[model samples]
Structure formats: C-alpha cells, structure tokens
Target: MRIKICGLTQLEDAQIAVKAGADALGFVFYPPSPRAITPEQAAKIIQQLPPFVMMVGLFVDPKPEWVTEVLKQVPLDLLQFHGDEPEAFCQSFGRPYIKALRMKPDFDPEQAAAGWPSARGFLLDAYTPGIPGGTGEVFDWQRFPASESPSWILAGGLTPTNVAQAIRITQPYAVDVSGGVESSRGIKCPTKIHAFIKAARS
Candidate 1:
C-alpha cells in the first residue's frame, strides 16, 4: 500500500517521513488550515526531498491565479482538491489532481467522482460541519466502494494502531494521514510517522 504523509511543515519532519518509507509528502496551501505552509516554505522543502518521493499540494476553493502562482513556485507532483471545485476548473491546471470527498451517510463515491474524470484518484475523508479535511475522525470503513479500479485513497483518523485494520478492510490503492501522525496541529512526530508507515505496510 502507498503511504502519503500530509500536513507537513518542517523540513526535518518531511525528511523523516520520506525516510520512513512515505510515498508522498503533502503541503497544505489553504490558509484557513493550521497545517498550511507558504509556497516559499514548500518550495524549499520540496527542493531538499530526494528523487522519487512525490510532492503534493492541498488546496480548497482557491482562485485560478493563486493555484497558478503556487504551481510556479512549488514543484508539486499532485494537486488535492478538498473542497467544492468543479471538474473544468480542476482540469484547467494541466496537472494531475485528486478530488477529496467528505463522506456523509448518503454520499456516492463513483457518482460524485464521475464529474472529475480527470482526477488521478479519489480521496475519501471524514465530514465535519466546517472542516474541508484533516478532521482526525474516522468514518465507517465499510463505506468504501467495491470498485476494481485502483484509484481509491483512504484518509481520515488513521493512526499507527489502526492503519493496518483500515487497510485490511478498505484495501485502498493508497492511504493518506495528516493528524494521525502529527504531534500538534501542523508538526509531525518522527516516531509516529515511522510507526504509522511500518504498521500500514505490515
């Protein structure tokens, strides 16, 4: 299973995550998020990351100019849209992006993903009243769609202790963790990061 360590802020933490067998590193661009990092900061961290490690940028309902500006500065391998962004708008960037869905009782994964056909994958996260993502709460794992396509990324409330169980149940193409391995709002814990990845893989 692929592991994506998200909400990364410090360079040391990024390095630690990468070394601990992370497949991708996510940098939040949404200002409202406590885990958000500036383009300059992300750029510096990205430059130092070793080759083959994917760099992801997380955005929410951003303006075209802002996304353009971020792309020019930060060399992101993927774009994660965690809010209400239309397919046309998402495709206009000419980069690979994944659409994040906030899980509700009646939300349809394939039906909602149908619009963004260009999306590289779909990330299923927990729904909160005002939160776009990173709520640190797990939804019903049984809600995972029974699709043959290898494009589902499971997220929300995954930790070292429970990631193995989550993966065993969902069998997602990849797994994304933000707060599960975090020591604080934005800071990642190396011990947690290492433990999480090890557990997920096992």
Candidate 2:
C-alpha cells in the first residue's frame, strides 16, 4: 500500500519520512490546526526534498484567493480538501485533488465515494464533532468497501502497532497518518515512521 506521512513541520522530519519510504508528505495549511504551516515554510521544506516524492497541501474551507496564492508559492503535487467545499470550487484550481470524508455512523463509504467523481481519490477520516482530520482515532475497518474502484485512502488513527492489520482489513490504495507516527504534535518520530511504513508494506 502507498503510504503518506502527514503533518510534517520540519525539514528533518520530512527527510526522515522520505528515507523511511513514504510516497507522499503532507503540509497542513489550515491555521486552526496545530500541525499547520505557512506556504512559505512548506516551500522551504519542499525545495530540499528528493525528486519523485509527492508533496500534498491540506486546506480546509479556504478562500479561492488563498489557494491561488499558495499554489503560486509552493509547488504542491496535490491538494487535499478537508472541509465542505463544493465540486466547482475544488476543480477551479486545475489541480488533481482528494476530498476527505469524515465518517459518521450513518455514512456509506461507497455512496460517499460516488459523489466525488472528479476527485483523484477519497480520504476516509474519523468524524470528531469539531475536528476536521487528525483525530488519532481509528474508525470501523469493516465499514470500508471491499471493491476498489475510484481509489480510497485510509486515514484517521494509524500507528506502527496496528497498521498491518488495518492494511489487511481495509486493503486501501493508500494510507495516511499524522499523529500515529508522531513524537508529539507536528513532530514525527523517525523510528515510528520507519516501523509504520515497514508494517504497511509487509
């Protein structure tokens, strides 16, 4: 499974994730998140990254102007929207994007995935009333559909300890983790990063 290590704030952490075999690295742009980083900060980190590593920017209900401005500054490979953004708004930027779905009790993964026909993929995150993502809590793995058509990414809470089971159960196209491999908020632990990647791939 493809692995994306999200919520990176430091150059060191970014490098560690890359070295540990992460396919993508995420930068949170929403100011409300403790893991958030400015576009400029993200740009600096992106510059030092080796080629072939996808850089993803996470935005939550951002103004179009803000997205435009960030794109001008950071050469992001993809955009991930974690808020209530309409299809038109997400497509306006002409970038391949992923939509995050907050899983609730009444949620249907396949039905939700069908709604975003234009999205590159769907990121399923656990729903916490006020939180957009990174709740560090795993949702019901059985809720994931067995068939993989549009490509689904498993997110929310995932750590080295249980990522293997999660991957086996969900069989997602990719898996995203933030706090799961963290030393603290916004800080990644290299040991955990390596372990998690190894577990997922194994």
Candidate 3:
C-alpha cells in the first residue's frame, strides 16, 4: 500500500518520514490549522529533500491568488483540496490534484468518485461537523465499495495498530495519516513514523 504521512511541519520530521518509507509528505497550508506552514517554510524543507519523494500541499477553499503565490514560492508536486472546491477550480492550478471527500452518513463512495473525473485520486476522510479534515477518526471501512474506480485513498484515524486491518478490509490504493504518527499536534515522532510505515507495509 502507498503511504503518505501528512501534516509535516519540520524538516526533521519530513526526513524521518522519508527514511521510514513514506511515498509522499503532506504540508498543510490552511491558516487555521495548527499544522499550517508558510510557503517559504515549506520551500526550505522541500529544497533539502532527496529525489523521488512526492511533496503535497494541502489547501482548503483558498482563493486562486493564494495558490498562485504559494506555487511561485514552493514547488509542490501535487495539490490536495480538502474543502468544497469545484473540479474546475481544482484544475485551474495547472497541477494534478486529489479531492478529499468527507465521509458523512449519506456519502456514496462510488458516486463521489465519479464526480471528480479530473482528480488523480480521492481521499476518503471521516466527517466531523465543522472540521474540514484531520479529525483523526476512522470511518466505516465496510462502506467502501467492493469494486474500486477512480482510485481512492483511505485516511482518518489510521495508525500502526489498526492499519493492517484497514488495508485488508478496504484495500485502498493508498493510506494517509496525520495524528496517528504524531508526537503531538503538528509534531511527528520518529519512532511512530517508522512503526507506522513498517506496519502498513506488512
């Protein structure tokens, strides 16, 4: 399974995750989030990264101008939209993007997946009222459809403890984690990162 360690704020943490076998590193750009980092800060971290690791920037419903400014400063490999952004808006950035679908009670994974034709993939995250993402709560894995289309990712509340079970059940194209491997909010623990990757790979 592909592993993406999200909410990375420190260069050391990013390096640790990369060393731990993470395929992608996510950096939050939403101002309200505690894990938010400036484009300049992200640029500094991205500069030191070794080859082949994908760098992802997470945005909520941001103005196009903001995204343009950030892209100018930080060379992000991909964009992940976590809010209610239209496909047109997502594609306007001229970059491959993933749309995050908050798993509400009535959420239909197949239907939602069909909606984003241009999306590289969809990230299925648990729905918490008033929270856009990073709730760190798992949704019903059984709710995922038996036949996957438009490749989907499993996120929210995953950790080394239950990731194996999650993989077995959902069989997602990728798995994403933020608080699961964290030492604290916005801080990643090296040991947790290593353990989480090892568990997911197994």
Candidate 4:
C-alpha cells in the first residue's frame, strides 16, 4: 500500500514524511483548514524536497481561476478536492485530481465512483460538520463495497497503531493520513509517520 501524509504545515514534517518513505506529501490550501499553508510557504518547503516525491495540493470549493493562480506559484504533482466540486469542475483543471467522499451512513461506493469518472482516484473520509477533513474520525470499513471500489485512497481516523489493519481490510491502492500522524492539529509527528509507514508496509 502507498502512504500519503497530508495536512503538512512545516518543512521538517514534510522532510520527515519523505524520509519515512511516504509516497506522497499533501499540502492543504483551504483557508478554513487548520493545516492550510500558503503557496509561498509551500513552495519554500517544497524546494527542499528531492526528486520523485509526489506533492499533492488539497483544496476545498476553490474557484477555477484561483486554483490556477495557486498552481502557478507552487509545484504540485496532483490535486485533491475535498468539497462539493463536480466531476467537470475537477477535470476542467486538466490535472489529475482526487475527489474526497465524506463517508456517511448512506454513501454508495459504486454510485460515488460513477459520479466522478474523471478523478484519478477517490479518497474516503469520515463525514464531519464544519470541517471537511482532518477530523480524525473513521467510517464503517464494511460500508466500502469490495467489488465496486475504483483506484482509491483509504483514509479516516487511521493511526500508526491501526494503519496496517486498515490496509489489510480495505486493500486500497493508497492510504492518506493527516490528523492520525499529528502531534496536534496541523502538526505532524515523525515517530508516528515512521511507525505508520513501517506498519503499512509490513
């Protein structure tokens, strides 16, 4: 399973994730999110990163024009939409983007996949009011349809302690984590990052 550590706020955290063998590093661009970082700030941190480390920029309900503006300033390998963006809206950027599904009691995995055909993958996260992600809440793993899942990233309240189990049960293409590896909101803990990656790979 691939590991993506999201909600990164510091350069050190980004480096730690990279050193810990993370496949991707996520940077939040949504203002309301506690982990949000500016393009200039992200650029500075990104400059320190070596080659082949994928960088993902997370947005929530952003204007198409503004999304382009941010992209121009920061070097991002992928885009992740965490709000009510339609398939056309996400594909309009001409970039591979992942759409987040706030997993609810009634969420249908097949229907969700059909709704966003253009997405490179789907990120399943727990539903929470006020906050789009980084809620540190896990959804019902049983709700995920075994035969209907697309290229997907399994998320939601996953920690170093439970990431291996999550990967074992879901067998997702990748696993995205934020608050689960944090010392606090928006702050990543290296120990957790190392442990999470080690557990997932084992």
Local distance difference test, candidate 2: 0.94
Model 1, position 171, has a per-residue lDDT of 91
Model 4 accuracy (lDDT, Cα): 0.89
The regions of model 1 sitting more than 4 angstroms off are none
**Model 3 lDDT at residue 117:** 93
Q: In model 2, what lDDT does residue 55 have?
A: 95
Q: Which model, 2 or 4, shows the larger TM-score?
A: 2
Query: lDDT per residue, candidate 2, 1-202, as tens digits?
Result: 8999999999999999999899999999999999999989999999999999999999999999999999999999999999999888999999999999989998997887776789999999999998899989889999987888888999989999999999999999999999999999999999999999999999
- C-alpha lDDT score of every prediction, in listed order: 0.94, 0.94, 0.93, 0.89
Clashing pairs in model 1, backbone N/Cα/C closer than 3 A: none
lDDT of 2 at 78: 96
Regions more than 4 Å wrong, model 2: none
Q: TM per model?
A: 0.98, 0.98, 0.98, 0.96
Question: What does candidate 4 score on TM?
Answer: 0.96
Q: Candidate 4: where are CA atoms >4 Å away?
A: none
